[model samples]
Structure formats: C-alpha cells, structure tokens
Target: MAVGRPRTFDCDVALDHAMEVFWRHGYEGATIAQLTEAMGINPPSLYAAFGSKEGLLKAALDRYTERRAAWMEEVLSAPTAREVAERMLMGVAEKQTNPANPPGCLLVQGGIACGTGSASVPFELAARRAQTEEQLRDRFARAKEEGDLKPSADPAALARYVSAVSVGMGVMASSGADREALAQVAAVAIKAIEEQSAR
Candidate 1:
C-alpha cells in the first residue's frame, strides 16, 4: 500500500491558535465559531480533524501543558530546591502578567466556568496542576535527603504552598492584577521558602 500524503493543515500551528482562544475565553465561553475562525479552518474541517469542540480543547490543552510546562523544567534546574521554587514563582509572576500574551494561565483559565458537561476539563487541568506540584515535591524531597533543605521541612506541604500561590497569582492576573502586584505576591511566597533555606 502506498503512503498517504500529509495533512495540509499544521496541527501544531492550529492548536497554538486554538489555545489562545480558550486561554482568553474559558472552555464554556469559547464558541465553536470563534475556535474555527481562529484556527482558520471551516466547521466541517475542524470537526473532521478534532472530532468536536471538546476534543479540540483537549488537544489545545495538551499543547499548552507540554510546551508551556517546559518553563518549569528550567525553573526546577536551580542550584537548590529553594531557588527552584523562587524561580518558579517569579517566572510565573512575570509570564502571567506579561502584556504580550493574555493575562492569567491557560491551565487555569480553560477550566474556570466549565459546565457539568465539561466537568472532565477542570479535572484534567487539576491533574496537570497536581503533576507540577508533585515534581516540586520530588525535588524538595531530594533536597532534604541531600541536606539542601532542612530535615524538618515537609516537602508535600511546601509543594502545596507553592501550588496555592501559583494558582492565586493566576486568578489575580486574570482579575487585572499588575506585574508589580503579582511580583509582590511571588515575593511573599518565596519568603516562606527563604526561611526554610539551609543558608
């Protein structure tokens, strides 16, 4: 059998566009027309490629998590676990409040206002959010074993604290909080980590 030709539309490019739509408008609020228009594909083509609006959103979410989450890896690469968290908080503050992109996080904005039919959307987002915190926890746990973190520190609790601050910053950014305000929020969260620092 002969190999078929590749898709004319670039799935990654289209998905990036779709992500912006859902990022700006919550899953419940983003209309199919808006999505199709933003993706530069007709309704039939959109359905054929993505199955449905939910499917398209799923693909978009996957792209967002995979690509955007790369930043976390960099933040996690700091010399110490405390630096990892501080970098994560400050980076989030910077990115969330960036004027070039939509304010707030795609992981957060996509899940808010999700109807009962869209319940899985929020759960999916929650899982992704939890996954990042889990990563942080593992890093902190290693730090404790390596003597970078105080033995008395609770890795899980610290992870939860950072996750909470990150989520709060997203919500505040969505509500029009300025970069300086978010920076202050990040600073407050980092202070707790600083107090826990071995140095």
Candidate 2:
C-alpha cells in the first residue's frame, strides 16, 4: 500500500480565498478553475479536502459565519431592542461597504441567482438567513419581556422587518451603493424599529 502526499496548502487560508471567490462571483458564477486558482490548490487537492464544489462552499460558509460570531454576539447583547437594531443595521452597513471585503454578504450573494441545477444552494443560504432572523426574534422577545420593547410589540414582525432591511442593504451594496447610502437606510430602519416598539 502507498500513502498519498501531505497537503502543502493551509486549509483555512484556502477556504478564505475560496470564500472570496464565491462572494465575488456567486456560487453558479464561480468555476472550479477560479476557486482552485484563488485558493492556491489544484483540483485534486480541493476534491480530496472538500469532497466536491458544494462541499467547499459549505465549508466556506461555515468559516464566514464563524468569523462573524463575535459581531453577532455584540449585536444581540445591546442594552435595548432599539440599540440591537441600531447595531445590526449600522454594522451591516459598515461591513457590506468595507474596502477590504468583497461587496455585500456571502449568504446573500452566494445563492441569489442559482439556476435549477444548483437550486439547493438558495435554500441552504435561505436557511442560514432564517437562522439569523430567528436569533433576532428571540432577542426581541427577550427585550419585550424586559420591557425594552412595548408589550404590544410583535417580536417576530420586528425581527422580520429588521432582517428584510439588512438583506436589502446587502443587495444595495452589491449594486454599488456607498456606505453613506447604507447608513441612511440603517437610520430609517432604526427609526422604524423605534416607532414599532413604541406602538
């Protein structure tokens, strides 16, 4: 029996590069050739390490989510529900426009335009997004219990509203909207949250 050679490339670094390629070109748009070139790994290495292109994408999504865990925690830990909305929307504004990263979000851009062959990709991304909305709903429910939001406020609705705005901001960013535009969008979202909480 013969042993295969050890991988020379760093998996994390390669995944990060693959993530950027997916983020920039989307799932259907990104080719294996592009991913391999960006990741600095050959096709055989990618297949051996990730099993398949979808596998690599799943791994990249996991890495992207893990990188944002801290920020998500901070947003959820805000002192008030309004502040939570403020932090979330404004944070997205900053993140989506950051010069260092590709515009928009991986979860949003990665599967937005998937065709029939890649249909499952959109659902996978949607499930991740729904998880975010669920988290927001739970947080807002807690805020209502704490009197941070009015008793009449619907936590689920507020969560959906915020989630929708956040997703729309990502689309806007992908469409070349600047930070200032997103900031204005966030401001309006926060105001809506405030009003909704009051009512």
Candidate 3:
C-alpha cells in the first residue's frame, strides 16, 4: 500500500506564524483563512496536524509558555521580593513594547474576548495567568520568611497587584502606549512594592 505524502512545512515555523496571528487577533477574531495563510498551510493540513483551531491554540500557548519559562525563572530567583516585582514589571514593559514582536502579550491578547462557541478560551488564558500569579505569590512568601519582605506585607496581595499591573500594561501596549510610558508605570509599581517592604 502507498503511504501518505510528507508534510512540506516545518511545524515549528507554522506554529510560530499561527501564534502571531492568534496574538494579534483573539480567538473569535482570528479566522481559519487567516491562520492558514499565516501558517502557509491549507485547512486540511492544519486539521490533520493540530486537530482544530482550539488545539492549535493550545499548542501555541504551550510554545509561548515554554519560551517564557527562562524569564519567569530569573524573575522568581531575584534576591528580594521587591527585586522580583521590579524585574517583572520592568520586563513586561519592555517585552510588551518591543518592536520586533506584536504589541501586547499572547496570553493577554489571545483570549480577552471570545464568543459562546469559544468560551473556554478565556478560562484557558486565565488559568495560565493564575499560574504566574501563584509563582510570584510563592516567591514572595519565601521572601517574607527570609525577612526580605516586612512581616506585615501580604504576599498574595502583592503578587496579585503585580499581576494586575502587568496585565494593565499589556492592555496599554496594545492600545499604543510606548516603552517610556510603560517604564514610568513600572517605576511606580516598583516604588509601591518598595514601600510595602519598608512597612
């Protein structure tokens, strides 16, 4: 029996293109035509490789998370809780405003809005965001235990605040905020974290 033909396109390259399309346009906003065009593959190939649009998104998100792992590790390993916040906020400002990639984060822009058919998209993105928040919270808790943060400081609250600020910065970047503006926002956030440490 004759075997099927080989896939001509590189899966990694295709996924990267698909991810950028998804990042620029939310779940409901991205059309199959757009994804296929960006991936340089036909609809059948997409279905055969990834199963469905949602499946492709899951794969893309996994790729995105993998790319972020190193940065997250470095941020969490900061010598103090304040440094962690500083690194996180400042890093987000720079990343979101980088000219090389799309404005706004994939995690933030990928699922901010979805129709009933794609309702699970938001929850998927939320879970990922919550995971990041949990990591920061655990790091802050460790900092408090080590006396790097004041005894009165709330690790969970600080983590949530930082996460909220990061999310806000992504939104601002998507809305055309420049690096300088985001840097100023990050500066204010770092000052707040520093004040908490002094309390």
lDDT of 2 by residue, 25-139 (tens): 9999999999999999899999999999999999999999899888999999998899999999999999999999999999999997788888899998899899899999999
What local lDDT does model 2 show for residue 34?
100
**Could you give candidate 3's per-residue lDDT for residues 1-199 as a string of tens digits?**
9999999899989989999999999888899999999999999999999999999999999999988999999999999888999999999999999998899899999997798988999999999999999999999999899888899999999999999999999999999999999999999999999987844
Write one digit per residue (lDDT tens) for candidate 1, span 11-52.
999999999999999899999999988988888888989898
| Rank ordering of all candidates by TM-score, starting from the highest | 2, 3, 1
Candidate 2 positional error at 187, Å: 0.5
Looking at model 1, the pairs that clash are none
Residue-pair clashes per prediction, in order, are 0, 0, 0
Report how far residue 35 has shifted in candidate 2, in Å.
Answer: 0.2
Evaluated at residue 125, the lDDT of candidate 2 is: 89
What TM value does model 3 have?
A: 0.96
- Which has the higher lDDT value, candidate number 2 or candidate number 3? 2
TM values, all candidates: 0.95, 0.96, 0.96
* lDDT score, candidate 3: 0.93
Off by over 4 Å in 1: 1-6
